[model samples]
Target chain A: MAEPCTRWDAEGRLATERGETLDAHFAACPDCLAARAADAALSARLVETGARWQPPGDWEARVFARIAREAPARRFSWWYALFPALAAAGLAVFFFAPRGGGGPGSPDPSGAGFEVQIGVVDGAQVVRSENPKPGDTLRLTARVPTRDPARVAIRIYRDDRTLIFACGGGEVPCSLADDAVRAEVLMTAPGAYRSIILTGAGPLPAPAGTLDADAAAARAAGASVTLGEAVRVW
Target chain B: MTPTEDNPTTPPRASSDPGAAEQAVLALLERDDRRGALTALMRLYGDAIYRHCYGTLLDADLAADVHQTVFVEAWRDLPRFSGRSSFKTWLFAIARHRCLDALKIGRRRRSRFTTDDDAPEPADPARDAETDLAARSMLPPLENCLGGLRAESRTAVLLRFQESMSYEDMGKLTGELAGSLQARVARAMPVLRKCLEAAGVSL
Candidate 1:
């Protein structure tokens, strides 16, 4: 018995491989050929007489403008609003609460001096410094929170320069002092320097998370306005 | 993320109507005034919407009302866009949904008696003078037969043949699986063929 003359028969296994055997079959079949021809004739006639349709003018700018207005506020606020509302609120309420024998007017120890926490995540240095600059020789001081010795790294960058260098991390395990971990480094010039204390807090922990609005703002807190500062700085 | 990412170019497209003016109107619409969206919609799709209504409902004036209603509904709902789909696709979905609703109501009102396939003779002299007048007239009857089909099959024919959408894009707009869409088209072909043949149109 003879097999049906299908597109697969004409084109070999390529049609089958691509999963286009149906299209191939329709293309090759005389029945489908006549049907398509009739369909084409009917369509052309209707189109010639039918009203034309097009997207409204200014559709692009309109759609984009709409997206632009919504995208910013929605994306940034997830962390921005959440952090200040929750973390900052908790901190505020804690600081405001009565402590020891003193009332609300009493001076707070945490408020008197700078508080810094440093850690290493996946071999990158993450530091919360009160007043750090590029040229300052930071002493390595750790109290107890430091863990994963090799995961800690200190990256220093000069102001107005793209050169980033690894000042510390490999052989020297960071030393703990009271509440801060210190690493000594010489900056080429005094400028704004960023120290990140990466903590593995997310589902997919990496060196650090993307700089969301809250994290960026937190990095700015208590950072020195001066290009360079003396010893005992956070 | 990008225009090309959403609207992949597969084939040459028909010259899009001047989109700048419609955009201007939309800007006004987005400004909390719907007059501009309405005016722009009428200018851009008034005729097309009317045709769509007529095609779907087979009534001229109701089609006109549907045309107006589409824009009004669009104006009311424009603020809800979330960018998950293109504005064009969203708008068409609305229009398609409305057409289907109107069709359901139309079916309830329509008698169950089926219409015969007898060809209506043209009374106009110019049409009579044409060498292929009968053939030309047969095309409209075939299209009218297409109109009698379920909404999806009718729309599939119009978008594929008239709008020149590829099956992939058609699937996206209609929310049909690509495999199923191909099968739908194949199934629809015989009905359309029979319609055209009954209308005395030669393939």
Candidate 2:
């Protein structure tokens, strides 16, 4: 056996200090060279063993094609659900802006006695959902005067549109958690700003791509619309 | 053989430093050339990710599925990646979680057996695990020694040597602190050394 090395011991313990000294000694020592070669071989073997189970050669192309197929459909699906609400909110803006929103259980003209507080999830606790950064989960909660499950629709816009996520609208079912109608949307897309919440008892329908009449028609319906704003940082 | 960039259907024979390739992907992202970014990303990381998934799950079919899923999800999440960590770290974070999730499902199916210290981690086949390890390895003794390590220790060692990850990057990928990771690898070396000795292999 070679004489004991000063840096790393005979027991194969590495010195915590004098790293350069060990490196210097290891470079010149034949036995140390052998040990390093063995370690290197071990690493190479691990890699070679892992290579036995490699995935298909065209995996990247397959994933790209899958993404291409899904991207437009995802946006279209969201848009298909959103067009009616856009009209509902547009008309609700004119009608509800004059009457104003309900506060707590007060007898307001809009009949929307629900308390709505929108917040972004910040780790453990939830904070107000205004001025959200991109990649935030926006939790929009609305408590109605009674436990009848309020229909909450939230749309956020920058210029024309940025995000539109609504529950209890069209085919989207209302999330009835804590006896309140709640909708949690994960905002992944960047460049989205401003948010509007619409609360109603029933479905808000629109012909979609129609005129301002849809909004006026929404006013005639018993629904109440509440508008909030979110300035999203890209 | 030198692999051409235009058609990378086959992986390179040797692993490469991904730094320049990662930079290229980032540049494409900056120019908003998502198609180019996708191409660059796949060419750069595709093989590494496949190997990673296969290494963790030890199932070729499952590894392919997860590999595809990671890239598809990467397309969605890459925009908001925030640049806080290297792209590989982000990608491997996704792979690690996917593999562990698969293992959890497998474990549940096998009656929720807890892995004790020194108990060989199951390589799926209950009877021929040793045979499987040996057959896959160029050095059967070294492979057996590696397989004998705890799952986390094995992962740590592989990421350090095979994947060429710094302890800090490994920490970011695995959500463990870097010092603990250092201690872990340091602790693992002696075990590996002792193991080879027990197997009558010269170090």
Candidate 3:
């Protein structure tokens, strides 16, 4: 006597056919038909019962409110830092522009002499904060004066002296023209990240070890302005 | 696991347009309206997520906790949602992972506290008819059978039937091959059928 096909075997075959009916097999095999019927009944019952499960009374309100409260704090911290710079720029324009007749070469009234802004690009938008989660990509934009042959490098370091990323070694420095210099850093680990941006007279040396060590090395390279910002990753 | 009694809230509003709902969610999230997007998402998939968590964990409180965690994580990661997968699949994947994590924590707690007296207890037959009726009304007898299967098997069954997910979608969401998921569902069906038959369920 030949062995009958098990339910698993029959179902596997049916699944491969993408819902094509196995009428001929079902017609010949009572056991398979019964099994199919049982499976259908079970599926129907599950869907029916599951459809009846309800969320809490204020589930939408609670979730929306909780996320609203928790999400913005982490997202807006970088923006809060940017706000001061923006306000100072506005103040400089308000306080000094009239005195200088709004001329193009009015001593660069913002007074910082250079502009460096760092954010993370998520989807279509460039977000201010590096979402403490691993795998976030950070975007850095800097505007340097045309006269200075400033070379740019970004170094990201974890709290324990482990180097996360370094760019603009001797071979490939992130050279800044009069326009904005843009670079991206992909965050790989979750911890405290200290990202140092170095604008040097020549090619910035690659970062080594901790932020302090990197800072010391850049200082040795002579006539470099280094800016450090702390990023916390969850 | 002790099953918690169901406390039904208002029934979900039926929407004829899932695409519109998805668009509305993405639009809000894209505009940085996290609250609005989450509110739309909750309206659309909250009950389904709760059911998935409850079915997998078999504990209402834990399910609710995982449900909240899912939304919170979704809101946090909403910016990175690149639309490679549908929002529904993405949300369910998150729900599945949170439930698995909760189950791991539960197992750890159970293992640490296990004693001779902590052996599995038989079902109580002395319960009143009203309680039984309530349980039956809330969940079919087949759910009790589902509770007997391993977590992976039960999840596969639920995702196949309750969620109406294709093997391909389930494979993508779970990072398993489609054939493997099909085999899992195939293996799970017999156990479910046998349990249902033993429970005197008609086919």
The top-ranked prediction according to DockQ is 2
TM-score per prediction, in order, is 0.41, 0.52, 0.55
lDDT of predicted model 1: 0.43
List-wise, what DockQ does each model earn? 0.06, 0.19, 0.18
State the lDDT of candidate 1 residue by residue for B81-171, as single tens digits.
Answer: 4445444454555566567556534432231222311111122224333423333344356556666566687777666656565677667
The segments of candidate 2 whose C-alpha lies over 4 angstroms from its true place after superposition are A1-20, A23-37, A47-53, A68-73, A76-234, B1-19, B112-145, B193-203
Model 2 pairs whose backbones collide: A91-A215, A119-A129
Best-to-worst order by TM-score is 3, 2, 1
Scanning candidate 1 chain B in windows of ten residues, the lowest lDDT window is B116-125
Candidate 3 lDDT over residue span A1-234, tens digit each: 777667534563446336655556666676666666667777788888787766677665566567668765764545323223433443211111112132444333344444556676787687646244567776655443332223545566765277766654433334332344445677786455566655555656665576655665665575243334455443
Q: Candidate order by lDDT, highest to lowest?
A: 3, 2, 1
Worst 10 residues of 2 chain A by lDDT: A91-100
Give the alpha carbon lDDT tens digit for every residue of A49-117 in model 2: 666656687776678778878887654321122223444434322111112244444233344334444
- Residue range B59-158, candidate 3, lDDT tens digits: 6777888898888877766776767677888788778767866774564344334342222211122332333344444555677777767788889888
lDDT of 2 by residue, B1-203 (tens): 11234434332222366676677677777877665666666666777888777666655677798888778767766665566667777777767666655654454334224342212223234534554455446446666676667667877877876777887788767657877876677667757876888988775
Better of 2 and 3 by lDDT: 3
Best by TM-score: 3
- A204 Cα displacement, candidate 3 (Å): 41
Instruction: Report the CAPRI category for model 1.
Output: incorrect
Q: Which runs of model 3 end up more than 4 angstroms from their true locations?
A: A1-23, A68-234, B1-14, B115-140
**lDDT-better candidate, 1 vs 2:** 2
Count clashing residue pairs per candidate: 21, 2, 2
